[model samples]
Target: MDSGQISIGQIRRSEHLPARIAAQLAAQITEGHLKPGERLPTEHSLSKTLGVSRSVVREAIAQLRNEGLVETRQGVGAFVSEKCARPIRIKDEELGDPQSFRALFQLRVPLEIEAAGLAALHHTAEDLARIDEALAGMTGAEKWTHQGVEADLLFHRAVAEATQNEYFAMFVGFIAERISHAIDAARARAVLEEIVEVTIAEHVVLRDAIASRDPKRARQAMRTHLLGAASRINLSLEEF
Candidate 1:
């Protein structure tokens, strides 16, 4: 086996050992390197292999079990659970992490860009009006407030609605709820502390792109606005 396969290197001394161990095992399981129901390496073997204590390995296995990623039977040690074959949900505790925020933002980029293009082709007068309402809500509200964040979410949600596809709207609505906290945090960041005017101006740019029914330009406008947003939030997404 490759040396990299056997270890996650030395965990930081102050880090949560159990969660770190669980994260490694969970990744292997999810990636199919550890197939569903396959027996996990014994606690003793894992402790030695990863250069951690047996107690740390044991606790990590317990954490995985709670997460539906693994199961343990008496005297048989842990095995990847059948649930590992399904899409796994991350714990609420992990949602606040920067990596998690980047993941959600990554998922948002394509959906939003495509939706903007579709909106240009299909949006109704009512859809345009709703989007403008959301924009006005943002422009009129105090910067960095929850109201501003809600308006921002509404602006995206309105674009999703304008796509004339129910599924697009539904999925974007789901994502908005999941990342509401991050939106709040991003809005309050000092780097974005004075970005209110810029934010509203960009929304106008997007609304006009769609209003003019230019699909290509709409997509580019949406992408540029969102990329700017990611920068304002200090989100480091190498793939973006």
Candidate 2:
């Protein structure tokens, strides 16, 4: 596999090939292989190259469209979507150390609490509906794996959206996703192993508080959740 290009095998193993392919390709664009307005390879060509059926390739392309990562020209091939330079990848190490795992929780506490507070204070009816939709998605997800994390993320993202600030929403979503990914990889530790359920329940607190539109309660709920998670980390941090 060329490190520069997304691999075909990777797509085949993807749980949601279409969406995953779209996100990967979009990342490539942000990372700079596909330039703005550059025509994507034809569906047939991509299908053959990626070893996926043409239908899969088309579906992936459609997923990219939803993300504003590509555009379809009537007679021409799909082109890389505009606003391609938006930097969305959030590296786990940014919170400073997966081994300790404490840093990740520490990083999440304050930022997310504040985001929740702001969201409650500013959210619109549409934003609340989005949160409700995300919450509804959490019902007995066969297992707390990929789907759980995605639904968890959707709930938090709705809070950010409620803030009505683009930067807040984008950065919060980016950081939360990275933090969640790191938490997922910490399965060897019992404390960290429960982080998914911990996170999901904590999110429900924020969601309910936000839905109530009481900023103070929302902030308090978020803060308490973060602090609880922070205390779970085995590592001690002097700064926090």
Candidate 3:
């Protein structure tokens, strides 16, 4: 039972605790701090060291396992996979910084614009319905709360799904999840009523463009909405 000297520090309570823990462990594995075939510290040990519950440690390990970074042998323990391939990820800290946050939006803009265009060409009635439902949720959400953020994400995801491309949906979901905290932070800093009203209005325009089957207008509308969103957060995406 060699619990190697893994230097994981105690984590503060946060909404993304499991993800934060997973990212730290992934970094260690990728940097060769944790060797291939080396067993990870026991869940109990990790919980104690990280100052989190065992369930949190378990969830973190599950995330690593899903990424092919760890293997769990029932009755034995979790070990680093023999061939550890690094997976693409956006670190939580990156979203907290202005430059990295802007960079991520730079990546998001083009993909979402293209998705909007394709969705305009391909979306079914059901897709439109889902988009409408999410929009309605956003309209009714309490100011700057988690519910508002979730509804906003759902709208984007619905549009991505309307593109009829699984990969678009997957990537949109990934990017949205990674940047959600930033979105929340931005909303918290802005005039709540004004931001909410302006955001929902932009979403309406984009939605109508897609529903009308106007691909060009849909793309332009999406571009406008995204740019406006950045502006609301006090981020200038004009040069990007």
Each model's lDDT comes to 0.76, 0.66, 0.82
Q: Candidate 3 on 163-195: residue-level lDDT in tens?
A: 999778767766776666767777788887788
Candidate 1: list runs displaced more than 4 Å. 1-91, 141-144, 191-193
Order candidates by lDDT, high to low.
Answer: 3, 1, 2
The number of clashing residue pairs in each candidate reads 0, 0, 0
Cα miss at 31, model 2 (Å)? 6.9
**Candidate 2's residue-wise lDDT over 1-240, tens digit each?**
233255434465645555556666766777778878788888877776666778777767754653456778888878886774344343333445544355555665677778888898889999999998887675455335556656666777788789988667656665565555444444335553366667667778888889888889998888876665555544444443
Candidate 1: TM-score? 0.59
Residue range 121-157, candidate 1, lDDT tens digits: 9999999999999988898845457668768877888
Using TM-score, rank the candidates from best to worst.
3, 2, 1
Pitting candidate 1 against candidate 3, the one with the higher lDDT is 3
TM-score of model 2 vs. true structure: 0.64
- TM-scores vs. true structure, each candidate: 0.59, 0.64, 0.68
Model 2 C-alpha RMSD vs. true structure (Å) is 6.1
* Candidate 2 ranges with C-alpha deviation above 4 Å: 1-32, 39-107, 186-188, 191-198, 230-240
lDDT of 2: 0.66
